[model samples]
Target: MTPHSSAPDLIPGDLPSRWNASTPTADDVPDLHALRSRHEVAAKGRASAGPEDTRSEVAGDGAAARTHVVVRDADGTARGWATAQDRAAGRVLVAVVVDPDLDDDTGDALAGALFAWAERAGVAQAQARGLAATQLDSGAFEPDARQQRRLEAAGYAHVRTWWQMRRPVTADDEAERPTGPGVRIRAVRRESGGMPDAADLVAVHDVLEQAFADHFNHHEETFDEFLARLRADPGHRWDHWWLAELVDDGAAEPVGALVASASLDDDGRTVGSYVDYLGVLRTARGRGVARSLLDAVLTDAAARGRSGVALEVDADSPTGAASLYRSIGFETSYVTQSWHRDVVVG
Candidate 1:
């Protein structure tokens, strides 16, 4: 990790002399929001990052273990931003956003600087954990040519494509409730202390772990880490989580799980629900466990008068997850590409 220094240094390669990198602070939310908006518009012709989204990323997370940096002009105008954090099992998620007003060469150089910072931070995190190798995870919208080039130059490969899908909530859709074969869906059990039951929480984590064991870039995260990450999100709700059980002759345990969070509109109004995870054990895949869980969440959202439900799926998922979502009226809103590389640290 680079030591905290206030001096300005030129980023190697083609960036203009006036642009310098510095650590970011909570006061930069407006600047970060502007950078993200310009990046989104240049890439997708639409703005995706909202003020709340930017604020949460900039201010909500515990700051001790994460790296946040921004690049600004000599006049102190923010031009780019980047964040690096350890997420999942052994993966570091690096996100970079650059203002589109800069020339192509300068923009590319800014991205390279951010990527280099991310790799250094990621390698350090892996070494601290006594791990030899770690995965670097980042993404780009399908249409961002500049970002695609930067990722390629940074030794990241295009690993997978994902589709952001949305389903409209209507009275008719709610009426078509799903009926799984002896499957029961209910909220995660809570203890007397008003916290999620430990055993049930572990069950949910286990189900998800086993379910995605064969999925792309599969990594096993500790149950404690899983719970911590979910609870860290501001939108997390206890009642929004559901467990699926297959009952035969009155014997049952959790066979699947569904987790969701509140989704707000651009204006920060609660508008819908977002499916964070929907996983079923391999042994329970064909028993309609997933369908039951999805229907349960959709029904609950409709009852609350939410606009709809949104979820992301691997476009080429071998489990036919996208097909199932399509059957339930999920339409693709946009696509994103996942880029990855493996870094080894001594």
Candidate 2:
């Protein structure tokens, strides 16, 4: 395996004299946020992920090996940003966004360069892992035609579509939460130290892993890997997690899991909550496990004075999860598509 210290330089050599590339840092958070916000507003009519989310993704709590690149003009102003991380063996995630204020031609050129930079970084990550090839995974909002065209230009294929859904919160929704028979939903147990019990945390992981075993892009992550990625997120709150269980004869078996994070507004206020992941095991499919868990999320978000909850669901789910979410007051706000490319390490 290639050593980290000996990793290849990812910056393109063909950049104009007025531009330079380097790994992103906390200082780039603002520029990164602005770049992403521009895309957000253009695609979804408003922004969702705030500065902290960008900060954490750029230099936050992630166990996965990653490298980020930001292009700056001669004035040292950030003009482009991209993130490429080795999420798992043979799987790399790349997110590339350029300054939206640039003229069309300059913006397109910068984007192409950044996308190429991310791909080369992904290859290095795969090589470091001693892999022959790796799959580069990236996504774009459905409305972002520019991003889609660029991804195709970078040799990525459109693979999957997801529904970004949201539901406004109200006291009445919380007061009327639904429950499942023989099932109970609650926060994962915490020890006296205010940290969650390791056992319960593992149960949540197991439930999620098993729950999504048959789902699309089902890459099994090690427990340590799972913990590091979530904990690194700035919006992650312990209280935002819930586990649904089947209780009978003095024993409880976890059947569903819901992991959520804070949704921040422009002024850094907690405006809503985002459901990062929600899953129910096959054995618990018809038992209302998913609904019970969501009820807990909606109730908690509402009680906290958060405006609403947002989540992404597979647009083509065989289980009709999007329909269920719609019936529960969630609306399809926008759509996003995943693009992937498999590349051999040089």
Candidate 3:
């Protein structure tokens, strides 16, 4: 499924001789955002790439500290881009996007070269942290056959699929919300100046850590990293966060947490609420904790006059999480696949 390019100056790895690669800067946000949108529309038949999203990806900080590179044509037009981040010594996340209008060969070459760069960068990151091994993880559209073939050519294996789910906001969506007895749901506590309370943040992180312990690709993320990541999002707001507590014998325990963010349209308008994370402790399941947390998000979104709610779920989750979302009105919008490659750099 490689793209056919008539260009005669193909390099050893199929990269075109006329193309140049360089690090992206803040000035490239507009162009990069457009490139990402084109790639998204080509891969998923929809455009969700926004300028704010591009800005965050380039300038954000946290556990997954990313570095970006852009590949430009001879005319100085950006034809492709790749970004990489490391969660740990051997665990890395990489993303590659290309101009959909480019020839198949150009697309293949860009992906191939960028993937190689990603592997090398991931190894260097791991070694700098004193690690002995490296793993490069990336994602692609399930519908893009050429991209899949390109990934396979670069030694990556497709491991998981995720469904982007969405539901329209309605006044009746939270009509029957119930947290059951001894359960309470409330926003994360804020200080006098409207700053989030540190204790509440820690509680939310703890609840999430315990909730996702048995989930797929679960990793141990520090509380600081968790906070930094959420704050790094352009749409993040402390008021959009919530915690569900269980009261037992006058002692309150945080059993669940929900993080919501504003989803912006391509024009920068707030269109909906994105359920960034919804987690409930194993011991808190079947007690309406997840339901209550979701209800809070929907109700909050409706109150803010936002369009609806959106989230992604593991398509093959053993807990039947997708079913739960479907029961509450969410439906699959699109599907994406995860690919991984392991490199030994010791």
Candidate 4:
């Protein structure tokens, strides 16, 4: 058996003290739930799940790629947790959530242990498979002072900043869908569990791949990875997907498509519209395809009674997508940072 397989399975009986560091079981549910609840309250409800849910969601039976670790005090009280997911382009995204009351040293020790585990398992897998370097991203909604210090001291450097902005939906702000010459927007219609239309999917992927190709730290993600990752979300909705089609003189097939969806909070309120992916083929750029897609999304949000739209963009993006968002009434709400470190593979 591999080292990972040999890792101990963490369960409830073994809990209330030290975690097994290997397998995560159902008994860890309540503790994990509490951790998530605390983290969300501390983060002003920005984050939902605690360590247990995170582990189950990412490393559980349906997980595509995951690395997880738990932190505990001497008496076995869970103190902190960390996890990372493997995404397209062979990149691993890391997150560290700790109890605010813990001392800097304790937090650091927990985060450090998690990172070290990731380096050994997640990072090692990526390198051996010829994947790109790993990336660590951390977000803080409270006094992130200690969290930030821990990351920096652990050799993570700040790379990007983002805003978690939101706006209230109102009938007055609502407007009819925007359309320009040769541009049309419509909702995605999937017949069954089969994949979305092949041509449409390809166009959507092409548009996003090309549109963000020049942006900061841009990397290519496989089509399968993109589809699998989004579908894995418990909140994913088929009707929530949309596409922007650009026609030639209103006669030819669509040359571009955009995919977007709405995400609800635990209360089931239509909190916001999440742009899962947006794209416009090179042949369709500069013709308002993107603006048309945004209009459709906005219209949908307003109809659904959503409060606002939320998405992330690279702060140093070269293509100036941020400028477009600003023009559309999106603004910065919070900032998140990215850190990178080189990896040596065998």
- What lDDT score is found at residue 270 in candidate 4? 49
In candidate 3, stretches whose alpha carbon ends up further than 4 angstroms from where it belongs are: 1-14, 60-64, 174-176
TM-scores of the candidates in the order shown: 0.93, 0.92, 0.92, 0.81
Per-residue lDDT of 159-196 in model 2, one digit per residue for the tens?
Answer: 99998899999878668465899888989888899999
Q: lDDT, candidate 2, residue 158?
A: 98
Q: Which 10 successive residues of model 2 have the least lDDT summed? A: 1-10
Better of 1 and 4 by TM-score: 1
**Segments of candidate 2 deviating more than 4 angstroms:** 1-9, 62-64, 176-178
Write one digit per residue (lDDT tens) for candidate 4, span 218-324. Answer: 67888877677766665566666656665666664555565655566645554677776666666667788777777777777888878887777667765566777
Question: Which has the greatest TM-score?
Answer: 1
**Global CA lDDT computed for model 3:** 0.82
Q: Order the candidates by TM-score, highest first — what do you get?
A: 1, 3, 2, 4
- The C-alpha lDDT values of all candidates are 0.83, 0.83, 0.82, 0.61
Clashing pairs in 3: 3-104, 3-105
Stretches of candidate 1 above 4 Å error?
A: 1-15, 62-65, 176-178
Task: Write the number of the candidate with greater lDDT, choosing between 2 and 4.
Answer: 2
lDDT of prediction 2: 0.83
